[model samples]
Target: MSQDHDEALVRMVNQIAANLGPGREEADAAEGVCTHLEKFWARAMKRRIVACLDAPDGGLAPLARRGVERLAERQAD
Candidate 1:
């Protein structure tokens, strides 16, 4: 279960990086993609955290918190 969770996170991060594009630049498309990803990720993360609030799996609370922390950290960067 832990492995599955880790893999899911990796997949999401990989997809985000892939969408970031060829290189870091000031191009409109790249900027738009970055902004879109940030906004979408933030909203999704917020929703997920709320949904996970009462999850039965006790171990998931910390993991969810970590995920949200990581998401926020990435957004800050």
Candidate 2:
């Protein structure tokens, strides 16, 4: 994906995480973000976001990163 696309994906996941983070435990928020991604995001989008995990400065927030990690695990299974 292009850098712009990657950045957009990062922003999107970060937004999702932020929206889900408030009023919830860390694990629950992460799970919610992961579930949203799994259920709503396209396969290509999910793969791209998960690839961001490897970028040194992917710009993903803590919750977003955790959520993406969970999504990756699900994809693996």
Best by lDDT: 2
Q: Quantify all predictions' global Cα lDDT against the true fold.
A: 0.45, 0.96
Instruction: Compose the digit string of candidate 1's lDDT tens values, residues 1-77.
Output: 35465445445544544555445553543444435445776565444433443445523333333444444455557
Candidate 2 lDDT by residue in tens digits, 1-77: 79999999999999999999999999999999999999999999999999999999999999999999999999999
The TM-score measured for candidate 1 stands at: 0.33
Q: Which stretch of 10 consecutive residues in model 1 shows the poorest summed lDDT?
A: 58-67
Best by TM-score: 2
Q: After superposition, how far is residue 34 of candidate 2 from its true place, in Å?
A: 0.1
After superposing candidate 2 on the true structure, give the runs of residues whose Cα lies further than 4 Å from its correct spot: none
